[model samples]
Target: MTSFAELVRYLAERFLQAGIESAALDARLLAAYAAGFSPEETVTKRDAALPPEVLDRAVEAARRRFAGEPVSRIVGAREFWGMPFGLSADTLDPRPDTEVLVEATLAWCRKHDLAGAPLRILDLGTGTGCILAGLLSELPNASGVGVDRSEGALRTARQNFARIGLDSRAFFLCGDWGDALADATFDIITCNPPYIETGDIAGLCPEVRDFDPLLALDGGKDGLKAYRDIVPQASRLLRVSGLLIFETGHRQARLVRDMLTELDAGFQTEIFPDLAGIERAVAGVRQSGGDGGRGKKKVGNPIGSG
Candidate 1:
């Protein structure tokens, strides 16, 4: 009988030969999932015989992964902010870089001593509801609305909210940016909008270009379409002292900041780098010359941030 350890090594070799990154990690994850055991448990049973049913499922999963499907999508979930969030094809996969936005928001809250405050949050293009879910997980008393233009994505986000036990505190809305929110004012607004340039879509890795929904990836002409829509709406949706946090394309930080700067000088904007030293998050606070909100001009995060 093939041992579980042998099976994982076999799958890892297949994945590596197929040019998939993180081959070992993916192999172990798929193996553990197919065996109906936690990854930790799988590691413990590595020397044991692999059940035929387990190997069967693992083989199928390997085929899909080899075809360029993201392991997260294949597994039907992705962990964000240390929590397992369900996924749907219509929604963008939750990513680590986007966590910078959550970290920024949380730091701003803590810096301003709003940790225990009851706050209202608005998330635009909230694919999988990861942004809202991540923030709500940290800011206990806060509740939010995750707005997405796609009905399928909206439903997925709603399901994610419920799955993470934040259903009662979070709701999903179908609309473009603030259209569905009307005059609703929030203390904080978060978004990880589509920022990939239209011309650049076809050049993306197959996992993103083929599997990720176009509505969640294609930003018009120069990749600033969603920014144009979201930035202006933030001015209206946010309360006087509200904060707007965004996850921008690695190279689009300056442009995003410039766009916001041109829209309203009332906002104090800051660009923050991800762990890789790439500027990945931008934060803006509406200021009316009087500490409208967390007025510090430092990078998005400063207090136990990241």
Candidate 2:
């Protein structure tokens, strides 16, 4: 019988040769997953005898890793904002950078005295429903609507809501931005839309560049296409004094800020830094007394439109 220690070493070396950056960690995580143990537990039992089935599953997972599948997809879930979310290819795997948008949104909600109120929220392009689900998990009194263009993605989000026991507090809509949500007015709106420039997609890591959905990536020529559509629509969805929060590429903060300004949306906008200290989130506040200029004029379906 092969020992866990020996299997770890074999998988780690194979992953490294496959060019996975976190080869060792990935090996341990997959091994632990197959053994029904936590990664921490795997460390303590490295010399334990591995069951044949467990060993085979671990090796198969490693082979998938070697082929460049994202570990999140391999394991079928990811942790975001301290919660585990089920994932699928139909959904964009939740990312740590997006947590920056969550933190900023929470801070803004606190500052505006909306933290504990039963405020409505809209999550545009809500892949895996992570943003909306995470926020609802934190704010018990909040309810939300999650919109996505992909039916598969919406199904995944619905599954996540039920898994997290948030189904009663959340609604899933299948349509492009603002179309399925025309009558909704929210106190908080959030999104992490596709912002990678079309040309830059080819240059991303194979894990992301190859495996992730192109509909969740290609941000058009300059990567600001989603911003243009989302900004105006978000403005309309928010109640007066409501907040609009979004995650953008680090270098596109100023450009997004400028776009929000052009909307004349009565928003007081500011940029928030991510863990890397790069400006990764931009938030705008609908002014207390100003009109949102009749909301977004229905533009031809931006995302989730087939």
Candidate 3:
């Protein structure tokens, strides 16, 4: 009979041999899930005998992991900003690096003395609603709208907001960029758009390329399509002095900044780095006089198009 400790070790070895990084951690996590225990609880129970059903479940999960499914995908949820968010085929798994955008937004809020203000936020490409939910959690009085093109993704985001007790303060919409949103309505806008170059997506690990929805991965041909579309709308959506923060691919921060600059929309831009010090987010403040001739710009499908 295999003990819990032995099964974990066996799984770890198999995972490592399969070229899976975080082999040990993944093994422990999958094993713990099979036993209906938290990963931390497994340490004390490691030496105990594994029930046949639990062992079988663990092995099956391990097979999925081996096939390149992410642990979060197998588990159907992921933690972002310390909150658990559910996932669906239409949504992108919320990742750790995305927290940089949250951090950047919060840092700016605090610096501007708006942390406690009743601010309005607009989250473009709100897959899973992680970014908007994270910000709303921190800003008690703030409310926000999450926009996504896929109805399925919006459904998952809505669930995520409800799960974290944030539904009352959040709304979800199906749309492209800001579209027909009222002008200067948001005090902050955050986006983590699909910026991966179409050609480079094939080079990403199986966990990403295979599992993450292509709608949330393909950024058109150049990888900056979403940014180009979103930045202009963000300038129109944000109020004077409002901030726009976006998560960018590695080395793409400079290019995004240049876009904000060329908008000539009275933006004051800055770049923020992730924990790895890669320029991961670009922030721009829509200064006074930055409405970018809002009155003359064309509108798209209405906000309730869904």
Candidate 4:
């Protein structure tokens, strides 16, 4: 029988040889998952013997990791906005960069005195329902609708909302953009749509290129298709003074802002930076009925060129 330590060492070496960036961590995670123990517990109990079935499962998981599957997908979950969310091939994995959109939205809500109200929110392309779930958790009085084009992705979002105990406060719908909510309007709208140019998908890392849904990555020829669709619809879906926020590729910030301007001449727009100091989020607010000058001047870029 292969010992627990021996299996871990073997898998770690294999993952390293396969060019996995975090080989040892992947091996440890697989081992801990198979053994039904936390990662720290696995390390503390490294001398423990492994059951044959457990070892087999660990080995198989390690092989999948070595084959370039994301560790989040391998583990079937990921952390976003300080919460755990389930994952599926049906949706794009929630990324840390998307937290920028949440942060900007939250700041806007606070500034507008809407943070504690029973605000209505709409999340487009709500993969894994991370943004909606996190927002609902933070703003107890807020309720949201999460929309995705894929039925499978909506199913996963529904399951995740239930898992996170937010089902009662949130609704999941299957439709493109805001179509499912034809007669509804919201105080806030958020999205992290596909922002990669079609041609660039081939150049992404294997974990993304091979495993992630293409529908979640390709953003048309210049990586702005979703922005074009989202901006115009947001104009119709938002109430007066409603806020629309979304994540975008770092290089596409200027173009996205321009698209929003052309979509709605009255939108007041700004950009927010990610942790890496790159401009990664674009936000716009509907102007109140008046001679609406653009609400705010462009702030200095917050995200670094990462």
Steric overlap count per candidate: 1, 1, 0, 4
lDDT (10s digit) by residue, model 1, range 1-306: 888888889999999998888999999888887887776788688898977988899999999998889988888899999988888989988888888999888888987889889999999998898888889999999989888899999888888777779999988888888898876999999988898999999999988898889999988898888898878777678886678888888599998877765655367778888989999988887765543333435444333334
Residues forming the 10-long window of minimal summed lDDT in candidate 4: 297-306
Question: Candidate 4: misplaced stretches above 4 Å?
Answer: 1-7, 289-306
RMSD to the native, candidate 2?
6.3
Q: 1 or 4: which has the higher TM-score?
A: 1
Task: Give candidate 1's total backbone clashes.
Answer: 1
- Across 117-193, the per-residue lDDT of candidate 2 in tens digits comes to 99899999998999998899888899999989899999999998898899999998888877777777998888888
**lDDT, each prediction:** 0.84, 0.82, 0.85, 0.82
Q: Which candidate, 2 or 3, has the higher TM-score? A: 3
Name model 3 segments beyond 4 Å from true. Answer: 290-306
Clash pairs for candidate 1: 241-292
Candidate 1 vs candidate 3: the TM-score winner is 1
In lDDT terms, how accurate is model 3? 0.85
Query: TM-scores of the models, in the given order?
Result: 0.92, 0.90, 0.91, 0.90
**Candidate 2 residue spans exceeding 4 A from truth:** 39-45, 289-306
The sequence of per-residue lDDT tens digits that candidate 3 reaches over residues 1-306 is 888889889999999999787999899888888888776668787788877999889989998998889999988889999998999999999889899888878888877778899999999999999999989999999999998999999999988888889999988889887885765479989999999999999999888999999999999788999998887676568787788889999778999988876674756677777889899988887766545434333322111112
- Residues 79-118, candidate 4: write the lDDT tens digits: 8987788889988888888888887787777766777999
- Go through the candidates in order and give the C-alpha RMSD of each one to the true structure: 3.1, 6.3, 6.5, 3.3
